[model samples]
Target: MSKVTLAIGGMSCASCALSIEAEVKKIDGVLESSVNYATETAYFEISDDKLLDVIKSKVQSLGFSTSDELHTPTEKTSGENYLVKFYISIALSLLLFSLAMWPLMGWPNREVNWFIQLVLCLPIWAWIGLKFQKSLVRFFLTGKSNMNTLIGLGTTAAFVYSAIITVFNDASVSFGLTQKVYFEAVGFIISFVYLGNYFEERAKRKTKEALNSLFKLSSKKALVEIDSKFVEVDIDEVQKGSVLRVKPGEKFPVDGKILRGSSLIDESMITGEPVPLLKSSDDLVYSGTINGDSVIEYIATKVGKDTFLSQIIAFVEQAQGSRPKIQQFADRISSIFTPVVIAISVLTFICWFFLGPEPFWGNAISNMIAVLVIACPCALGLATPTAVVVATGRASLKGILIGGGEIIERSEKIDTIIFDKTGTITEGRPSVVEALFNNDEETTLMDIASIEQFSEHPLSNAIVKYSQDRKIPLSEPDSFEIVKGKGIIASIDEREYVIGNKLLLEESSIEFQQNLTPNEIGSYVFVACNGVHCATLVVGDKIKSTSKSVIDELKFLGIETWMITGDNEIVAEYVAKELGIEHFVANALPLEKSSYVESLQAKGKNVAMIGDGVNDAPALAKANVSMAMGTGADVAMNASDVTLVKGDLSKAIDFLKLSHGTMKIIKQNLFLSMVYNSLLIPIAAGVLVIFDGPMMPPVLASIAMGLSSISVVSNSLRIKTII
Candidate 1:
């Protein structure tokens, strides 16, 4: 199946995303679909690409706009303009509120002020309140209710009731209405709701800014050599095999190999390292990295979406669109919240009308309007997603690439962390340390290096470099064959030789008079000729400086740390002791490492596996949360959920801390919303009126509702401050 990402518009809340997702799934041949309100994008998978147009039409039918165009369009100006409208509405609201309160304050001329308040509220509702009206009408047509439906119904009820009192003064007075007016409440409700949206839009924009920062690092234009002459062209015009000439201090425009010259390139954007790397002939340079002091010419290998920079951008975009498990729960609650609130408002109206004291009509209408105004579900809808967006963006800035919301949840719960030895705890660069031979060490080394020269394994390269540095003459091998994870077999000097691990030798039924093993803390590779042991060589790798500190930090947090390695028991124990790790599994195969992780999880531990080699991919996929070193193999990175761009083990602590902090903020937001609704709903329903308590005014209800949403957003933004 093929997929497409469309830029969606007109999404106001999480419920809006749900509405779009529900419609998109109905299209024939659509395998799956996800709509994210935070990013305002819709991703779809289709079995047949021919039905794309029909799917787009289905999305638009739900009253949302979409574009398949390249390069994201700039945001609309509605947020800024809405703020201006709110200020004007608020000014008029304050004036109308003061005039309507004149009678309660024992001031004169309050009896004739209803007409003036009504006239002032007209502009507020007709102009600033039109959005709520339009949303309410759309919902009425589709039988769907949202926050807008509640606000529109509450404010419109107040304005219409107040207008009736103003027009039929004599009849209202006869019915003991006393010309009571709530025009001021109508003005305040609309103003506060709009103000809430304006603030929300501002916070959402801050999250978008974090994502856009990545796109800004790329250069738009490039200078290339055409027929030995330099020419400037757009980055898109430079194709594969094109020779691109980059000057000092300019960014590389495409992934390429150096053809001439050398320079120190800054790869901080891509690798999260501020240090400059030296580049020369045959070295690779990626797009968006800055060339530091010398001009260089390179031939482009990958262009457009195939470049490394584009992949990072695409990765971040896809991650931003994913919903965490907590966010899914929030969406489900919001889907049911609006309708339940509408039902409560109706019940509140019935209860107040039958039980209210003098001026029953005015009290019943006011209290019922208060109930509707106070119960907006916007805060509930925004609780999880806003926190996820801010937390993910903050993590990106710190060089931790989290794949989705579920990673945040999973990372927080990790109680045990398992680390692979090679390329993880150790530097993964092994060098021959000692050579033990029964007859001649030189003959064995030269013969083994010759056959291993054709292999790209790490140990193979180390053997070849060791032989070359010793000035040992090598002979060609015939009929070379490699057994993965074991050894290589070839014919050297009319004799069959095997070079590999002890397991490979045992499988070959090799026998030697004395099997000498190295006592040092390093790996051993045995060489055999004609099914007999010839020599044994030892290789050692340096441990990373941060491994011990990382282990200490994890232990300090009450988490257990374990080391799993394919190395011998002695080497594994030596490294584990140095890092202060208490648990380890030595001489483990790739499948055995994954089984160990599963066994820990079966014992109720939340396990996280960190590795940077192809052998670690299965274990990485088996853990609750997996991290891949930025400098590691591509297969390992693809199998992991989190990528440490600098390969710094210290970032593992940051990942856990970030998850804890983000989950804390989400819980706080959800609590604030739930508490606000719980306390205000009863008062708005007039339950307090029994004890002679003040009934909740529609104006105060609107203020409380808006503040609840603003507070949730403000709390989410606090995640950016986490270190």
Candidate 2:
């Protein structure tokens, strides 16, 4: 075994990398291969005399252009060049087609003279067949090939053999003999196949562009400072220890430290948190994050793929490139399908040639062509990929990012829906709702928020948020100190302040609020100042407005809903009852969530677990369908098959519905393709002549393909426009 490394381009996400790896590994003599997506390369170990060109062809066939080609040979790709070539090809093919049909358009039989037909079909096949012919030439030249080799040899053999016979003999048709013409089959196949793949390739390229565009958001140029004067230079031209100046409101182009000035930075682009963070001198800033408030300068520490934005892109690319289990089935089946069908066509021709005594050459040629045209996998090829791409695209717009086709299929039928409680179905933050002052007009509520802000706790954030929302003015408390075991203590305007639970108040020897409602399902904090009770802040966490609607919609769709949480049984029961969820496993541990999901699965139900980010990671990995929300933890995001980027629970069910619709479309397409084939294959094999009449295989093949392709495309188009 030896090592082989090939550069793999246009893989923007992990799934893309995985798909390429999967395709290459399918070939014989390929022992192992490792593809590094960030570097855009694949390394392989192979046996002697293995077919590298076939592997490259396989990659190209799966829609990702390989990087090993030294010249720009794939016509043109990605930009305006591609558009020009595509339009030109279409126009040339269409013109040639029209010219060939001109004489027949005015006829009663709509028929053409055989000589005229041969002349007309000449350019149509040659002009458009150049690509196929080129590949065919390369295959014979190198002895390395795959389907292209098969297509080239089979079609070229049929066409050239027929052309020679026509030129040599006046009688072009011979029964059980060496004379027959199949120029039409070899001529038209490549032209139409190219037409079928153009738009499909376009969509795939755009999906890659979306990732590239994200990476492109980083500034490619930087302002370098030398001798106190700023000089413009490309980011790659600058490196670590290079001083740079970043103007206020201008995006910092590189990951660096602040050399001069202080400013706030908006990191929402990477973190999804919109709050502008305060940064001072010597603080590090990430590339592409917005600088705010003041003019700031920094040193360029990192650039290019080393930048944070590039790292994020790399992770996404790697994940997308990892192939899913189901796609392997489709690819293996589809790749073999065409070859098998073509073989049957050859066999059908051979049988007819030997068995029929007074055989007709046209009839035998038609049967072979029938097999080629009828066996086309335009429908089978489109069946899974079309719906998968569409469903995944549609799901993305609705906040759910499905990983692959298998996930899409699983999402189509959801039986038990499990939701994580905090952050997912309820407001995770607590707030002060009621503040009471007894026998004092000292602004007790205001003083409590002032002290509470000094502490770092979820309960404190709740109170702070509430007080700020109420427009309460808080003073910086003097002599601020946190009582380790109890709470925080501070002196506001020379007056001592304390905020915490009952223990802190007791330690302060102050009266405190008691009998706090347990069913309140929220953390609480108290306030005291100058050794006397100032106010009691009732902290409460509210349910998200969207949660109710999400649940209601799911119920309306007849989906069974459940809520599982580590929160107390009382709190869990209260929230579940409010949302009208009947099945709940409250106070369950993180592992228990998966256990509960497994229990549902034990009953033969397809379970979808909806969870808060990190806490639900395990359960998400366990469920048949895992949907993680925007607010979820990074672990949850990675674990779940479907990630709701918007954190909209309503889209959870909507995405399910979208998958269901996509599956329905897939089923419909398969049914139509099979039904059409069942009728056409038999008829093209001359099965229906005894009953009805005879039909041309070429015309029938074109019709079968046109119908299948147009319907698949039309149905898949629904995904693009879907919400």
Candidate 3:
């Protein structure tokens, strides 16, 4: 049998994990399996008979995906099944509560029949705790530490010892445990935490809905042309070269090329572009894109798991399991915590047996169970994950996606943030910042917009967008010639049209006025129509509205901001100084940017690099942390740890604060959980039961559990203010 760990996505609660575990157990040749809602991964032992493919296909059939292939792990959606388990546990608990208290309330109990208490609580204890028993066995076999070991030790000792004492000891002996079983407490330990796990899983599921939403876009069926007839078929059944008929307003069912028709396609799902793309024969189409008008017959090239939906789902799932940058501390804390609590619980039994008045096995077992029940790592396990879920959820609302926990963790420590010029700090798209015309003709705007549309360039694109806003339609031109690094030459009827920068105009020996404003930053292009200067199109990129705010926020938060751009020194300096960023590297190439970020790291500075160009990919991957704007090239986005959805800078601020808040909460939760466990469990075992009155185990467990939960939840809620 091969044991492989798969990071499972779409788990939101402990019960959801449990459901997945139950499903996994149904597979033939599967020996054991477990799913953790907090960690969002499924652990399973599969025999040689069950292939990995079979295991994975079965998992996918259940509306979830596994990340067995990703080089790194990622967070995933925890959905609704987990909530069902929570309700089940709660319902069972309520039933037990009513049953156990009936005797106390004098509701036809043999005045406290021990057997009645045992019967009411046994189902909950056994049903809810079977998983814990499995984990305990694993722990004993591996000698590896886990929270379940302590629980198994405490609850088992409490039940067996109490049963032994009750069977042998006659009543009125005054031995603490022999007198009363507290079997209900054993059941309560299993049920109470299941309640916590339920709520936590629900919260986790709700927070991770981003990936779920992303995965929902894939089309399930496609209309395939079969025997000269159009018929709908499941997407998975459609193979390559199958001509699929896609109707207007339908989402494309598979990745393919336009074979027999044309339409406007909304590629925004993948590219995040707001505009729709016109499709003709041979125009590539991606699966899940919306078709605007005209029926399109496209040949399918990929489907099912090979499609982008499956890739994205797999990416999200795998990313959740990759090593976290800041989880070392948590590992250390959890490691030290388990053993220390175990030792303390053991010592509690010994101390009460030797030094205290109620030193008998009865109270000794009660104290041990108290120690295990009270010292649970619910808060510890929850600390980091809760904060991450909350922070990541808030980020998604603002169109930011954080893949790794360490990105946020290390991003919080970043002292310097380097921004690329084009598409990072600037809008990247050139527009007519200023337009000038000597003539007062009413048709001047139309003339320029129409002419510029004949040529494709940054400057021409700017004029086109501008003219479209003014309701101008471009006309086709005859004899169009594009001069490299210069102007465009087109013939309108018989006259010649020359449009380009000053250098291009000079090369053509065409004179044009240089009445350009000095303060404006952009490339200057002068257009001459029919041997007369018509208009000048000034193309330049504008700084994003949020860039300055991001810089100022970083500075205010005590981090330094810097810039590196391939633009001219003056333009780079202008943007840098305007944003209040003091450091900059002007005229940097792709390699230069990577080297600069590398140098910073070598100097012991943790640097975060933000960029959007394909050239920025290397630098982004090189940085201590990386952020990609939504409009960034695909490679850059893939290389980056964080992606900004709106191609804006404001989210940079949100990420930093979110991580810091989460880490703070983790510390608070750990401290709170530890402090409560240290103080209360001993007291519950009747440490001072003889002096300050014997404290009830149930009430003490409730208070300790409450304190741990309150601090954990409160700390987690603190991150809600980050956005």
Best by TM-score: 3
**Clash number for every model?**
0, 20, 18
List model 2 lDDT by residue over 1-723, tens digit each: 676556566443344465567668888888886665433567677885466777778777755567663212222253343344445555554543454345457642222333444564465456654554555564445333333434555456555554555454444444333432444444444444454344334434333433454445578788898787989998788777888888878888888888787766876444322225668778888887888767888887887778766665554444434433343233344335545555677776776566533455655665776555555444654566666766776666666777666576777778779988876787554555455666453477677777778765556667777778879888777677865435687777777777777788887788754433222444456666678766666665467788888888888888899998776677688888888887777667555676788788889988898876444655776677788777655556655677778777777767777777777777776676566655665565655555666544344555565677678767777766546
Candidates 1 and 3 compared: the better one by TM-score is: 3
Runs of candidate 2 with Cα error greater than 4 angstroms are: 1-343, 355-363, 388-397, 433-442, 454-458, 514-519, 538-541, 552-558, 566-570, 585-592, 688-700, 715-723
lDDT of 1 by residue, 352-407 (tens): 67876867776665566666655644465467667876887788788887765556
In order of lDDT, best first, we have: 1, 3, 2
Quote each prediction's TM-score.
0.57, 0.60, 0.64
Question: Superposing all C-alpha atoms, what RMSD in Å does each candidate have to the true structure?
Answer: 12.5, 9.7, 9.2
Among all candidates shown, the one with the greatest lDDT: 1
lDDT of 3 by residue, 352-419 (tens): 77765543765666677666655655555555656666777778887888764546677767888898
Indicate the residue-level lDDT of 295 in model 3: 91
